[model samples]
Target: MADDFDVVVVGGGINGTGLARDLAGRGWRVLLAEREDLASHTSSASTKLVHGGLRYLETYEFSLVRKALQEREVLLRSAPHLIRPLRFVLPHAPHLRPAWMIRIGLFLYDHLARRELLPGSHGLRLAGGVYGAPLKPEFTRGFVYSDGWVDDARLVVLNALDAQARGAEVLTRCAVTQAQRGADDWQITLGNGRRLRSRALVNAAGPWAERFLRDHTQGANGRPLPARGLRLVKGSHIVVDQRFTHDHAYIFQNPDGRIIFAIPYQERFTLIGTTDVELPEHEEPPARAAIEAAEVDYLCEQASRYLARPVAPADVLWTYAGVRPLLDEGGSASSVTRDYLLEADAGSGEGGAPLLNVWGGKLTTYRKLAEDGATQLGELLGKAGQPWTAGTHLPGGDLGRHGVDMAAFTAELQARHAGRSPAVVARMAHAYGSATAGLLASPGREIAPGLFEAELQHLRDKEWACSAEDVLWRRSKLGLHYTPDERAAVAAWFDAR
Candidate 1:
């Protein structure tokens, strides 16, 4: 006999976890399967902003912008600890875009959706303020706008945690070897030799969506299944030592019409880049996308045009890349639609099990995508419950009742952990939020600087972290600060256990 489920979701990225969370909460017996650690790919390698794509306005993607803006407000309120309001400075470049056009665009961005949690956009004099200190003297004027920053990997993990709490079985490092569609259910075999039966299946495989359907799934008639065409675009980012002191992020417009962001990261670094290089169909998406040398030089050169101190490849402390599986719109990589499409195929007869394929989505819109995906599933599988995720929090997101005032909560945590390092306590507050109290309930040994054994155990037991890479890099980004011996020690701790 096989393990049975109402829904079986493939891929453990943001979309897969988000769908599982929503479907399971609505009373479905859901199982989410991931081939590797959660967010080991495209999901974790984002530029890490929850914003209405400001540049998308140039291509007249107003609807997408508006939808993202709406979700930005909702997501900010949902996870105050993990998501925080960020101010962005767009330095004026009259040659690239006239000031009037920019003003109009900012107006639409500000008013496109209901605004409450974040402030609106405004013009700024970048001649002598904190925001102007890092920019070249030529950039005397600019515009300031509001968006939100998120811990991308942690966000994915939190959604999975919530799904499990709602009784969904989340399996990591588990790949689906074969899936045979039955008239009313799907018979699936896993790499670990487990069998599962589900009434419905969702392919939320991100960049691998096309391949998953083509190679791993079989139709009821024993025929091959066709998948939606995808345009794979590789985006790369570089992290350098902090160049600016302020909390504000910078959005630089390049001569090629593409934009790059220089955001303050981890309190000590400036995160930049995202070159849109389209990958050929013949190329296979790798487990982790590697940043190209040309991409790094392009980012450094473009950013140097605005900053007083030029950025160089040698200055890059770390680099990452992600392949976006966008809908095939036959345009340039940067111009493709970030909006998603959910295509559901109910196998040939009445009461047939359905297969839903999720395609083309961005970080800001994952929640809405999941909601829409669930609505479609309900129409095919029968309604389980009315939408409940729109008003609910994701795990440790309950900082308060009315709004997410993260500062207030951080200060409260600091006061309680007076004996501990203020920085460590603050980091915990930001990463774990209200769960910080439970995280520090006992004084477990500090394995490395600011990383305690208790935190490692929590990650292993509750967050499904099996390796040092999951805990150090994806879960917390403490890898950047750890010494070689410290990192080895972490790996040893996992091995011993």
Candidate 2:
């Protein structure tokens, strides 16, 4: 806490954690300060896919799509425990989008970037195909394409964990209340009344990037960097009982020209989502990223468009929303670019400290974005950055380039543990990977039935979890399955801790 570091990062979301990890791996002493638990906001509330933006092709964003497609493969190799291949079924909707257009889009997605791990896209006859069981009989044909699904929040936490292993300090629930840029360094004051100094600063505060610049980063005696602003678009998701038996996900195109995904989640429920509604102005962060009444109905109607069974609001078991901070390109929320921008100000610090601001990035391309950000920062520091994250494996992901067999690995772990439930074994294999051994050694690892006390304690003691919300919601998606008493019990345990 007394040292002036190489870089002080001001967010703990994907972008910030990615940058911190990259920088620390490059031998930079880094300190990351987060206002709350990591992935507490937009990073956790994602659609949970690591594919190229297939819909961005319709908006003519080829570069972003190609970059994302390339990064998708890198991440799948880097963290295969939490990231795996997922096939998506897109039912042919003649009225919404022409078949030829869809064909062209799929072609680009397959060939945009060099593919190594995933198979190419192809058409499928849905009459007896595995993907048609949940859809109506009218949907006689569809298309299958390759993509990847991820535990988004866990990815961020893993990056932070890797950074810590590389000698970076991560401080959660510690906000940067103010930053005074000096001619050679910056003095930052945190919410908990601690202070630290850094030779450079990186503002990666997602939706609060602009606000942090306007308020916290003033008094530096230099002009504010001209920020390419952000448009806050809120996206929401609802969980329901499993609608389909197949492991594949569905990409349903709405009559309104937007598309949403219904993916298999946690082996018990179908995860349907994502409405792009403009966010309302507020002075403080919204208490909840709750899905609105109309948004719920809208998603249900969209699902019913293809499903044989009518999905109503009452069918929804849980809902979540996240505010996407897109580049303010003056378009409808759905059309905004998923690309990112890194703005580096060399002389903004009164003491010649560099300040870099990050804006507008999607989860799929976070690695590349962090690599580029590191390049810019390295140049400012008179050091050239060599890309290293692509080949390196994150923690618990040592199962080789393509990853381990989930079934075989879980079976072996269950055999070792003897008394662990199959559900707990499988979940641990996916969530903890090779790190499961250390976690299983903790007391009450299974705090409640099916829920591991060790997993919760591991999260709180090591992963910066502070409350039941942090454990159940972001660290793991167990909220939908936990009963009221079970939830209260978890909360009580957190309180005692």
Candidate 3:
């Protein structure tokens, strides 16, 4: 039997959604299948930064850095609503990297990225500057630079939404059971006993990339590529009430050389993370366990080194962990490369089909990775469609009319929603961007009389949010602020919906 689609993409993470969007926009019939809800895996559990990996420069990954740096602007332009510029303050310690080396690295980082709207790197006298207000007196110097912050889970949904708008079929809770390359197309079997045929297949199963390939053979000639190994490295983060009153994020260096971030999250909380540890595959959500005593000690210890008031595990209101599906390079977890590898298996015969496998990537580089994957597919399919996503806007990203000035845009929103609290207005603006106006304009119906009723409805109606976990844990960080009763109420509302 022949296949059903021009392309079948397995995985609903950022890469898979991105590929589906890119292909479907080019007029190809595409189908994307995810075993769970969109971004129910590593995609939602990122460090939540659209960074250029300044640390990767130490490993001499110039090409990767350049690509990520360039994509930073592309993503910012594409989804100005879910992504925004964030300033970072990296404090200098006398015993750590020398001042000269840090300056040189910053210089390289600034030059690596094309400075269109973001400010360039500069020195900070931590004792007197805005960044030093929360720091310990011992920290007298720092480097301030720019990157972008993102709602990681929302990003995945936005890509999927864009793909669907362009006519792609996105099926969540639908798992691909098997795939075999055929003479004229690829035959794929779904867990629901539904069969699909496609001209091409993309194995973007993220952590399950190897497992998916093991089940799916390539080529009509009966040859299959060996499953590529992945190194599952778990990273965790903690959230606490606002530690400081600044908009800038902090990148704290630990005694062991690992770095952690204390970023401004939601307006009322600070986000801290993460610890790198190796865990066995097939582990059930490795991050749901409580922050280990050692990990908390390390975070508090490092945070205390730079802050005026010491932080404790008791201060942590919430925590999350994600496993980075790094390409196995046979090294310690910390030393593994954050770069991605793309492998295409094109069968030998004239009528053979093509299969693309994506292994290892970070959230920051997903857009570029998808563009490259589509280009590779274009080469195999002999169709050279002009790339359209680099400058295209993701849902709710139409910030061009607002001149991209969040402060001005937010001021306008506050005026429009005079009855809402400033906190709610700011949250909606940041979360929904230009679409906030539309969400607020909806019919008057209260799902729950809390921080936001219209906002919750918007998420449920448009974003496929089915539970309080999807809203609190993934859609936004409201779980940190809501009381137990409030949480239960929200849960009831989500269930009733």
Candidate 4:
């Protein structure tokens, strides 16, 4: 018989790993199973911001905005290295919304929560400002607001790392093929022959939430749960070479009454994204390989509306898409809410082991969702204790307040690793923060321009990175820097390993 655990989480995305980390920290024996690498899906393919959904205000989603705003500072503190404050410029478009309306939205965005780290939004003159140089001369005025940029995939790895550190077992590439509820416990069967018994189960399977519930969460009678209240929305992003020299990002307004963000990414790229198109009823999780031609053209057209240099398909450096598993609200995909809903068999009085289904969450609310989900399941298992995730740091997040006091941290890392390139030290500091000591303890040959052999091994051993895609794309954005030959070499190294 497989050993019993307090909870067995059946997803390795942010929500599932976050719950595992939180519950394990609370002294619960936890195990998490994922069919693939951590953050291989929707969580990694985000606009990569930790901000209150500013556009949601127009939809009158003030509560979601407030909740998201409240969690922004908390997240910035938790992963200082991966997340940092960014200023976003919203160029005025009289054809779209009026100045007064934009002001109201910015006002609500600033005051919706207790913001301590971020500066409030304010108007800006575009004539000679850093935020205006790349924009067309017609955009003479704009609004500058505070949000945060994050390495979205790294955030997931950090949570899983922290969970493992707290004694939770994280199983990547291990799918839960079936689960059977037997009285107060659940017997889970993995894709492999391994099995596990747990007192509670959490289905935090992002885009596959509904399908997972139907196929994996079985009852004593061996039947799946009824799949309901779910909608899949595909959000796509396009990356292009840097169009501007500044650090600020832009929130462009489209004539279609939708908005898109063009943010500075990885020092030499501009990341633009996100169209909300509902997936077909038959399609569950949309393809990740290519963004639709319409999506690519839409993003280029929208960004070109503001950029002095119009973008085209030929300018695209990368393109990716992910399907959001949202609550079915019978609305247009763009109009559908970003708020999350947590439901449980325990609450519905289903007489078996507790099962929590995580549905419809954005990156901003992931930590809060984890806390709430963990607290709920904890209470069901009579292990409810002090809520401890807030103000707590994720792995390598121990940089000081505002996450800006990092000069010393980088300098110190460079000093400690004498004879190492300061550039490498700086990059590692941003990637691993205070944990750079372990990663740099041994000298490593440079496998690629910025990547080292030791770094690849560390990811494989510590973070469960199994492929070139895992290390290059998700663990860090090294794929953007690696030459084709370098990428092949890295893949070969993994094969040998």
Q: What TM-score fits each model?
A: 0.98, 0.96, 0.93, 0.97
List where candidate 3 sits over 4 angstroms from the true fold.
Answer: 1-3, 216-225, 280-291, 348-351, 449-454
Inter-residue clash pairs, candidate 4:
none
Question: Which residue runs does candidate 1 get wrong by more than 4 Å?
Answer: 348-351
Report RMSD for candidate 1.
Answer: 1.2
Best by TM-score: 1
Error of 1 at 421 (Å): 0.7
After superposition, candidate 2 runs with Cα above 4 Å error: 222-226, 280-287, 348-351, 400-402, 441-445
Query: How big is the positional error of residue 432 in model 1, measured in Å on the Cα after superposition?
Result: 0.8
- TM-score for candidate 2: 0.96
The ten-residue window of minimal lDDT in model 1 covers 344-353
- Per-residue accuracy of model 3 over 31-97 as CA lDDT, tens digit each: 9999878898788878899988887787788888888998898888787768899999999986878
Cα lDDT tens digits, model 2, 1-497, are: 64678999999999999999999999898999999899988999999999898999988899999999999989888877889999999999888888888898999999999998898999989986678878999899889999999999999999999999999999998999988777778888989888888888999999989888877875457555344567888999999999998899999999888999999998999999899998754443364577899999999999999998878999999898998888888778899898999998776444467888999999999999999998899888779469799999898988543254656666777888887677777787788888886766653745766776767767887899999998888888777788988888889989987
For model 1, how does the per-residue alpha-carbon lDDT over 279-300 read when each residue is reduced to its tens digit? Answer: 9875778877999999999999
Root-mean-square deviation of Cα positions for candidate 3 versus the true structure, in angstroms: 2.4
**Residues 1-497 of candidate 4: C-alpha lDDT, one tens digit per residue:** 79789999988988998999999999999999999899989889888999898889988998999999999989887877778899999999988999999999999898989998889999999978777889899999999999998888899999999999999999999999988887789988999988888899998998888888776777766677766667888889999999998888999989988899999888889999998888788675754635799999999999998999999999998888888888888878888898999887662445788888888999999999988988888889987867898978888878654255667778777788878888878888889987887888874777778678889888999999999989989988888977899898889889997
